[model samples]
Target: MTEKLWVFDTTLRDGEQVPGCQLDTREKIIVAQALEALGVDVLEAGFPVSSPGDFKSVQEISKAVSNPTICALSRAVEKDIEVAADSLRFAKKGRIHTGIGVSGYHIQHKLRSTPEAVLERAVKAVTFAKNLVDEVEFYAEDAGRADKDYLAKIIEAVIKAGAKVVNIPDTTGYCLPVQYGALIRFLKENVSNIDQAIIATHCHNDLGLATANTLSGVENGARQVEVTMNGIGERAGNTSLEEVVMAIKCHSEIPVHTDIVTKKIYETSRIISKLMNMPIQPNKAIVGKNAFAHSSGIHQDGVLKFRENYEIIDPKDVGVEESSIVLTARSGRAALKHHLNLLGFPVEGEKLNEIYERFLELADTKRDIGRKELLSLIGEQMDHSLLVEIQDISYQGAEGKEANAEVTLEMGDKVLTGSSKGNGPVDAVIKSIKQLIEHKVILDEFLIQAMTKGSDDVCKVHMRIMHEGKPYYGFASETDIVLASARAFVDALNKLPIKATN
Candidate 1:
């Protein structure tokens, strides 16, 4: 029988610690439901005793989710355990995860207690939690640096106190895989009551080894792995769920089974990214934009001939549609032809050379050349006009508590000028542009993000508009964020029909 590994997802409790990645109560509940649908065995909802918002989020998540076991994090204090228990009252399966620092440095400085005192408190906390919930997990904070014998003592005490699960966490992410695995093996060998509870591995990613450490622990006898989606958490991150799950699936020698629905990984990742207003890195593993993208000539040729030659995993297996063979300046004839053929244009030899030259010229002017631009360039040679004659207008807004906007519009033998006032400079500019264009469209989503790091960074605005149940997206960038947002909204409005319709 294959050993089943429980996937404990701490995206809510730990992943929310990512800078600027805070989610409101409703958003936390939404993510918790998605996690349940994605088939996570355990959802670490939040630290109930941290704040009222966290407590409310944990309570709401416990009430909303029924399939997965809802967990709340707490310190080894009775008050904290009570808070955790109260928050998880509505959960079908509730778990209280409580821990205290056990390392020498932590015991001396952080806890201001001796090793024996810390061990006594660890056992007491677990016993207290066991009285409230049958499923209780105890974590030995900074266990990676703790003395092997002392760590074993704490684990033994907690297990004797009725902790169903014992988490050996590399709190500082300072241990190598070999050393971390050795620690878990040592605990298994030395701890008297080790067999009474399951061993869990919670590794941080400070040195980018959280997944490696977690996997190493599994090989050494850990049955549970604590992780987060997209590797989001405090400082660097926690173990990534996608990376570990895919690793276990692909590695036959270390066959581990999880309850996660692999197909829903991408969807959940995207939902969390959108809700947190954080952009997933294009090169991030599994769910990233470049995870399945191939660009090099040699690689593209091999992929065209046989996909398995370059790709170990199929994109469709992970719910991604297909691999993108992008054309760049370094692209060869084969790649160029492939992209052109994808655009419904099949040409060769002199025709291919002609188009390739034009592509190079356009590539030299722009960072990236789109299919529409390439088609237009090719159409110019066939006496076919593909250019849409819509004049693009630019607008800007002033700053201050009460700011105004100036708009300039240019049409054939006509120029329209307008101004408006509103709550903010961006709103004023948007209202002014609407007055000038007289277009009616519903703004579905409007977002502004800094394109680069700095105080005076360029702002990029992405806007979506819905008209007659169809949505259109537009984007624009400017040094001034308010003006960038206005321009993006106007650009989306321009995509709509000029005449009014119900």
Candidate 2:
């Protein structure tokens, strides 16, 4: 029988520590419910004593969720423990996760206390928190770099004092897999009361070795993996729950299994990203937009022939519908043909070769070839052009008393016209366009760079707009900077789900 590895998710607690990624009480409850539905064994809802808002969020999450052990974080102080305990009053299964710094650097610089004092504090905090809740987790803040003997001493003391789980974290993400695994093994071998508590691994990804270090811990006797969804946390972030769970499943030799609902991983990631307003990086593992996107010709061909040829895990197994074959300059005729067929353009032989050549030219000059671009390339009807199109645009100079622009947009067969003034020609054009459409949009970023150095040089305007906290990206190039900005803005607007007519 495979040993069960506890999936302790700290996305709400540690992951929320990302500078701007804080989730309110209602948002935290939504995420807690999603995590419970994902079948996490433990959910560290928040650091209750950190703030009243956090305390209320943890309390509400405890009330909202029941299957998973709802947990609240606390410091080594008695007040922190009390507040954390109070937050989980309604929880069916509650855990108090409290700890102190254990590394010599932290003890000397951060805490200004000696190892013995920190050790005493850790034990006391755990003993007190254990009295309030049956499940108590004690974390050694920087245990990866702490003195092995002293670390073992603290671990043994905390276990004897009543911690049911002792978390040895790579607080700074400073250890290599071998070094970190050795550290966990050292505690298992040297700590006399180790068996009294489950050993947990909470590794960070500062060095991009979080998953490796986490699996290493399991190899060396850790049965609990404390992680966050999409690895969203402070700095480089913590071990990713999806990654650790998938690792256990792929490497049957690891001898452990998690109760996580693998298929809900993608949905959970998106929910957190949307509520936190933190867009998931396109290349982030498991939940990233490009996690299953194949753009290379060789990779696309291989995947098209046999998914297993290029994919180790099926996309559906992780809630992703299917692997995306991105059409780009790097894509081959096979991928182009495949996508073209799907888009209702069935060209083969000479016609396909001609279109493929044109596609290469288009793709080389651009970043990607989506369906709209493909259709335009094949001389498809303007009826299916971009969601919005610039019919006519006129811009006054930027330094004029009042910059002015007249714009006309075509949405299907209808033409919408508007005009406005602004501080600059680009702004004037965008303001006029906004008068023509109905969408709450913020110009999050606007950038214009000259492709060439001359006065009449070609300019590329790249812009990002936010709608309901989600970003839409687009770019356009032209000799006139104002025109480029207008086109870029409209392109981005077209990508968004917006209403044009009243």
Candidate 3:
């Protein structure tokens, strides 16, 4: 039988701990709403004792989100539990997440206490939290470093003490997947009342094994995973929410599934990045821009023919409209903006238009306009006087007819105009732009799709060109695919040296 895995998100609590990325109460609510829609089982809002601001944020999120269980973190202490319970006064469902370190190293060095005392404290904490809320979760911090026998002893005590979910964390990210999996197996075997509560995995990423360890734990009987968006947390960060979710998705043979709306993953990731001011590394799995981008000529040609040749998860499955193709020599503003968003340098409005022109000029100088060159271009405050701008565009197409496009462009202070007809709107747009720029280039491929479900939904277009034996890419998003295709055409033309593929 396929079992359901609970996705316990700690973005507001752990993710917010990223330095200089702290969010206030309102921003926390924004993230909470997004998480609710994403279908996380438990939303760990904040540590009530950490700050007055965090306590208030938890309170506000409880009021704002009615779906997921609003969880508040607390030490095993009375004050922490008191504040945690009070913070969730408005939550339709609430959980008091309380626990202490169970490892000998933590007991002796960190807490200056003995194993017996720590076990007693763990029991007392769970009991205390259970009294405040019907749903209580207990975390055995540093369980990775703790003695397996004693860890089982304490975990059993907490389950008997009324913990509905018991978290066993690789606090320092110190354990290998096999070792972590064995520990979870050992606890399941030793704990007498283990069936009373769910075993949860909370692994860090210090050794870059958080996701591996988390999966190992889940495979070994854990039914819950504690994670943060973009993997933002202390040091190397916590287990990535997207990575673990996608792992379960791709490896369905694991026979576990999350209620998370996989389609909301990208949108939620962006929301967290923007609100927390924490840019996700482009190489990060799942929601990263490069996750679905094809750059190399071999890769581009392969994916253009069949996406499954390279992509495992569809970009659209994660709220991204489609995969992106990076230019071999240069890319237009649309591709630039897409890559920039993935690389964490979003620009908008008038600033976007200004940067758009500058990006075209930068493309003229670089062959492959990937992240590194684009970052460098944005860094140098150079002259953007020679770049071209697109305006006065129109497209005409229907379900069973030919397409036509007309466009005007301003290049080097000169206004030029052109019009063309093609088998499709996208083709027509590219043809018109080629006529205007008087450049000999072939439209190798183009992709057009609606980003949302509405009559006026945004349309995203990506296209590739072969110019003088080199390939370039361009993209645009507009209300109309014809206009977006025209924008994409102009984008590709801007990268040309006024010639065709050699």
Worst 10 residues of 1 by lDDT: 380-389
Q: On residues 1-502, what C-alpha lDDT tens digit does candidate 2 reach at each position?
A: 8999999999999999999898788888899999999999999998888888998998898889889999888889999999998989999999999999999899999999998889889988998998888899999999999999999999999999999999999999999999999999999999998988999999999999999999999999999999999898889999999999887878889999999999999879878886776777768878877788888999999999999998888888988777878778999888988877765677888888888899999998888455567776777743433377899999776643579889999977789899999877777899999998778788755667789988789999877676765556678999988888988998888655321221
Instruction: Choose the strongest candidate by lDDT.
Output: 2
Best-to-worst TM-score order: 1, 2, 3
Cα RMSD for predicted model 2: 7.0
* Ten contiguous residues minimizing lDDT sum, candidate 3: 493-502
CA deviation > 4 Å runs, candidate 1? 376-457, 460-476, 480-502
Ranking by lDDT: 2, 3, 1
Q: Over the stretch 158-261, how does candidate 1's per-residue lDDT look in tens digits?
A: 89889999999999999999999999999889998898899999999999999999999999999999999899988999999999988888887885788888
- Each model's TM-score, in the order given? 0.82, 0.80, 0.71
Q: Candidate 2: which stretches are off by over 4 Å?
A: 372-412, 415-502
Q: What is the lDDT of residue 398 in candidate 3?
A: 63
lDDT of 3 at 62: 91
